[model samples]
Target: MTGPSPETASRPACWRPARADDLPAISAVLTDPAFFDVLGAVTPEALAEACAPDGARRLLAFDIDGSLAAFAYLSGCDGDRPKLEEFAVLTRGRGTGTRALSALLEVLRAEGRASFWLHVVPDNSRALALYRRLGFGREEVLPDFWQTRNGDRVDLLRLHYDFVPAGV
Candidate 1:
């Protein structure tokens, strides 16, 4: 995808490799009440470890005007089909999340990855809509796929985004 348009230039959001120091902000976004139902529980320590360079996961933080606006967590980074484990945006309806996802896809394309996937709670219509808009297709619905902090099971919808190599 192309870069953000001039209209979004005023509040430019950029994506960068997440650092250990960003753990608190990542945790706050993950555990925010607005996303609690979709994200469940996430601790800062866990986020820090996951974002570590040697870990199986990689995290990209979206910054706007020097503050964390959102984050994307990818697992199985060493493999061909990495999974987007978490994508949370603290500042919603501002297009930050879309920009973050686009930046991530560019990174993955540069790394020669063919596709990636993510699982979302069935009730998260907003996220689902965004994913669809970004060319992600619904793969399947896995019943009782995610367990909440309260021990409740939630159905998950799997979405996949395949990268068609340029000119292919």
Candidate 2:
């Protein structure tokens, strides 16, 4: 049930490469009840695999002190800009979300990734807002894109984010 302290001010922060050892701590934040309510349950083993050394994808973030205040996952990039598959924050009403997204964008930009794509559960209003604020837009809505816990499929909103500067 441990969570990040409330954010009192909005400030700039940077991100760095994440290691396999960070997986357990990162998984703890991701598996929190508050987060599970939206993304559903995910196993730590899955996270570890995603963060494995040989994986083409990567997970990165900015931690406040020793706590993972924010986190994100980039995948499917290969030779292109990787898509941000997931982003999360441990606190609400704070700028942690924005900072995290910004950091992730910077990393993608540095890697020459001009654009990426992802999908969101249409019902997650908060996540929708966050993605929009981070410059993601709805590209399409896939009906029955994701199966739910109750054996019912729900729609998903496909979103795209372009980080390339104008005329680039």
Candidate 3:
């Protein structure tokens, strides 16, 4: 709901709503072969349009040094179930992805969202492990869920994280 607390001040990265100007950087992250292979092709123009305030909600994680490290895009926020359209960390093994995801969840919980879900290519074992570690449960697998730029159809695993209201 609000910015990071004092305790998180020392954290290496912080998450904030992505702005129009961040589209290029976000596109760069999305264009990474590692991310593209898992997700799909995304041009700067397309990313800019998708992340527009009127479209999807985009969050970016910037390092203490003000460098863009990761980003997450959420679609269908107006509905009860928001879907994580894309999530990627430019710098791997630095906990950027985990931190970004944690921040997003905190914001979602504060907003009283019931649940959130994401579709990950089944072959993205690293991402799947991280999602599981973050308490996301594998729901189902959709065959040929995504067709890549190369025309390869990939199966995707749907994962979800349900929020339990406090004092329940």
Candidate that scores best on TM-score: 1
Candidate 3 residues 85-109, lDDT tens each? 8888777898877877887788788
TM-score, one value per model: 0.82, 0.75, 0.79
Give candidate 3's total backbone clashes: 0
The lDDT of model 1 is 0.79
Candidate 2: which pairs clash? none
Measured with C-alpha atoms, the lDDT of residue 127 in candidate 3 is: 91
Give lDDT: candidate 2, residue 24: 70
Tens-digit lDDT string for candidate 1 (1-168) = 786556665665677778887887787777666666787565566677676654678777888766777888888888877999889887789887787788778878788887889998878898888898888884699998888655679999999988874467
lDDT values, one for every candidate: 0.79, 0.69, 0.74
Score residue 52 of candidate 3 by CA lDDT: 55
Question: On residues 37-135, what C-alpha lDDT tens digit does candidate 2 reach at each position?
Answer: 356444666566566433666667577655567667767757565666667776767888877777677767787776877878878898888889888
TM-score-wise, the better of 1 and 3 is: 1
RMSD of each: 5.4, 4.9, 5.6
* Deviating ranges (above 4 Å) for candidate 2: 1-12, 32-37, 40-43, 52-54, 165-168
Clashes of each: 0, 0, 0
Candidate 1, position 119, lDDT = 91
